[model samples]
Target: MLALPTLSSNGITLKPLTLSNATDLAEACQDGELWKINETSVPEPDKVMDYINTAASMPDRQAFVVIDDLTGKAIGSTSFHDILPFVKRLEIGYTWYAKSYWRTHVNTTCKLMLLTYIFETLEYQTVGWRTNIGNHRSQQAIERLGAKKDGVIRGNRVCRNGVISDTVMYSLIKSEWLPVKLELTKKLNDAH
Candidate 1:
């Protein structure tokens, strides 16, 4: 199993996801608007803990709470999932954030930290992302991070809403990691 290190950088931190974060996480999910795009959307506030627990139970998943360092509050969740040990590949996904945090440096900073750990510390060959075909927002975000689109897998995934969707895949290979890391770092620094 890939170890998940607690990551902190540029006013954002990622710590192991626990049931204790349910309250804040639940609050973040209140908009329910984001539900449509989430791969595993919690239908109601009460389902948040169950969702967290289910994520916790996955052997291949290392879930984490995306914390806002300024407030010390849970603002979102992201993880390293769908890892292939022998193949030396993993995904940075199962990620969702509060409505208020969208379009902010939060995601950029978080990705910088996660990618740093995945490509630097773990020295993984590839970090991948899979989003619903209709999820243009997510696709754009991954692209902005310099992950190349590897095309879509038609009807390969089922969303929480029971919709069968095409999975649009993207990845950052080892050779691309360093340049992308520098670019992301510069972007994050420029934000301040």
Candidate 2:
């Protein structure tokens, strides 16, 4: 992956993930249930820092700190993983938010900002999404973004329970980005 850049729009900002955000990210992750459907968890602040560091070191990934535009505080994290610039494709995964931000405009805004950059700025052709097959909330949100369900695959090994789990895959190709982007823009406005 190329050097990641800070992205801002729809009252949200995505800055490169950094260790300085560990404290806030840890605090935001107080709800252990947040990890129930995620492949990883941070049960402690130090672990959160470790997570941030590990994400930063991924050669094919670019993680970002989701900052609340109003409070200007780190509220969550998201990333573009499995970047294949040669193929013009990437996966949007490893996203999580504070329990307080759930069902709010935070995720929608961040997705819009990130997707816009990927499809328009970065010129990626396909943005993929994947989550535990049992993670209904995540699957639903991805669908809401007009990402089409591609298929399911087993052996996604990073499951929270330490068991290899089935992964539900979805994709938003460039052809679908226009309508999805429009709908997401409308959602952000309606949310306000």
**For residues 1-192, could you state the per-residue lDDT of candidate 1 as single tens digits?**
766779898888999999999998888777555654556544357788888989888999989899998988888899899999788899989788888888899889899888888877887899999988887888888999999999989989887778788989999899998899899989987888
TM-score of each: 0.94, 0.92
lDDT of 2 by residue, 56-89 (tens): 8888888889988788788889988999999999
Best prediction by lDDT: 1
Query: Stretches of candidate 1 above 4 Å error?
Result: 36-43
For candidate 1, give the lDDT of residue 44. Answer: 54
Clashing pairs in 2: none
lDDT of each: 0.85, 0.83
Residue-level error in angstroms, candidate 1, position 169: 0.5
How well does candidate 1 match the true structure, expressed as C-alpha RMSD? 1.6
